[model samples]
Target chain A: MSKLSARSEDYLKAILRLQDQKKVVRVKDLAQLLGVRSPTVVGVVSGLKEGGLVDQEHYGYISLTPEGKVVAETLLQNEELLRTFFEEVLNLDSGEATQNACNVEHFITPRCRERLVSFIRFLEICGRGAPKWLDHFRHFSLTGEPPPCDRCGEIFPGDRRGCEKA
Target chain B: MSKLSARSEDYLKAILRLQDQKKVVRVKDLAQLLGVRSPTVVGVVSGLKEGGLVDQEHYGYISLTPEGKVVAETLLQNEELLRTFFEEVLNLDSGEATQNACNVEHFITPRCRERLVSFIRFLEICGRGAPKWLDHFRHFSLTGEPPPCDRCGEIFPGDRRGCEKA
Candidate 1:
């Protein structure tokens, strides 16, 4: 759960996708999907197998173990949520959203994923009020300012001489 | 632009934040923020200087030139969008969302960023119809099934071999 790298996660997810589409996955197929070499796919597959996330025979097709299936499902859920957020909430194009989600989904932690889900729900329920605080919550974008102090909700001016007391 | 690594972007962002806060950024300070050694910071600083993104003297405090500020701002914007998406939509915890945004923001492309923004807008304006699709989407979460075919939009039976011919 905690040990997968983004690269490894990509491979696992790709395998899962292939499984969904074809019910079987091969090294060459995975390599083609990932735009990587067959050797690279082999290396990653070996790693995944060792991790108990993949099951493979000598030269047969590849598939996810039950645990692998769970991980892949979770990763897919995160990727879709992120893609939807990026595409529906942010007004991004579908292709770009998918690509970005593919990259971002791996690095996200479960806690962060939950928060993102909450934020999306708030947007759904609260509407306009959501963006106002969201704008401030992410105030780092607004002028490259230091985040407002969590305690006082005061904008900490970036160039202050010393606001140690304030 | 495409040449900067996530680590490099993090360095640039740290320098930009420091410059905004202190009006001057020292090598040791950047090293502290990045948890790297001073020599490592010096190397990255030299690269940034070569890239025309930063101004540095032999031993003087470092600062970003105007061009560097633009890049930093761009990175900050992407990070904020990602944070908002994660926190507001996904229910991810704020602190964890922020940290994940920090890690992935640098890697996202402008095209992808635009799509994410658009997608968010779509979700906001799409209204009640949105929740209906949520269950269909959640099917992917429950089962490792490929989404209904892109063309016909019919859920493929588990025994199906491929999308139906048009």
Candidate 2:
């Protein structure tokens, strides 16, 4: 885990995504997805095979080994979790959140990942499958005002504050 | 931003932290901080100088240029934000969260960073400078149980679910 480079992790995750998309992951497919040359993909695939994380036949489809499946699935789950966090919790655009989530999946430590999973569960099951503040945030984003009035505890449109004397 | 590698970002951040610690950043200091050899640091420092990111006197102290200062400060702030999110928001240990924050700072895009900053601010000011769920989570962790009985909202130890018919 410590020795894996970000590049390799990206490659692995890319392969997993391509597979999910019903694409047979070949060197050319990897190259297109990763924006690298086919030769580079071939080299990295060879390295992945040597590490026993991937299995490839001669000029054939690339597939994850059993051990590789565990790693790839965990990475995919991490990316999905982060994407949800960014898009649902943070109110980011879907496309931008997905891209950022992919990059973040490689760097997050296991402990942080566990904490996030628990937090996400807590958020989902706590009341209405979302926090109260999340609704307030959505309102604030649309109105460019604070969530409710601080003094009166009422949602406002930024112009009316009941307690102006304070 | 797209052209920068994770390694170079790490080097820039290391220099910034060392500088903040009031240490004279020479090639040797960078090498020690980065766990790389001195010659590797020298090579990267030369590249940084060529890019006008760092200014180095001949065999003397290394310092960031204005452009470099901006980049380094942004990275440091991103790291700090993430650390706070993990530690304050997620209740992770300080040392582990700080280390994870360092790795996360490099991969987060500007858009995501902005969202995170806003989210952290929201968490800080939402109710009592922390979300209501955070207290529930702390209690849950201490007792190794869910936050209160589902039916009555009463805190309980594990195995004490009041609703057995559901």
Q: Indicate which candidate wins on DockQ.
A: 2
DockQ list for all candidates: 0.10, 0.26
Which regions of candidate 1 are displaced past 4 Å?
Answer: A118-166, B57-60, B81-94, B107-166
Cα lDDT of model 1 by residue, A1-166, tens digit: 5589889989989999999999889999999999999999999899999999999999989999999999999889899998887775555679888988898887777766765675465444332211332343234332344333332212111222232422
True contacts kept of each: 0.21, 0.24
- Residue B7 in candidate 2, Cα distance off native in Å: 2.2
The RMSD (Cα, Å) of candidate 1 is 14.8
Output the worst ten-in-a-row residue range by lDDT, candidate 1 chain B: B151-160
Task: Looking at model 2 chain B, report the run of 10 residues with the lowest lDDT sum.
Answer: B151-160
Off by over 4 Å in 2: A1-3, A129-131, A141-144, A149-166, B1-3, B129-131, B141-146, B149-166
lDDT of 2 by residue, B1-166 (tens): 3355777888999999889897678788889989999999999888888888999988889999899989989878889999999998778899989988988888777878877777766554443322344677565544545555452222211222344421
Q: What local distance difference test score does each model get?
A: 0.69, 0.73
**lDDT tens readout by residue for model 1, B125-145:** 321222323333344334434
Worst 10 residues of 1 chain A by lDDT: A151-160
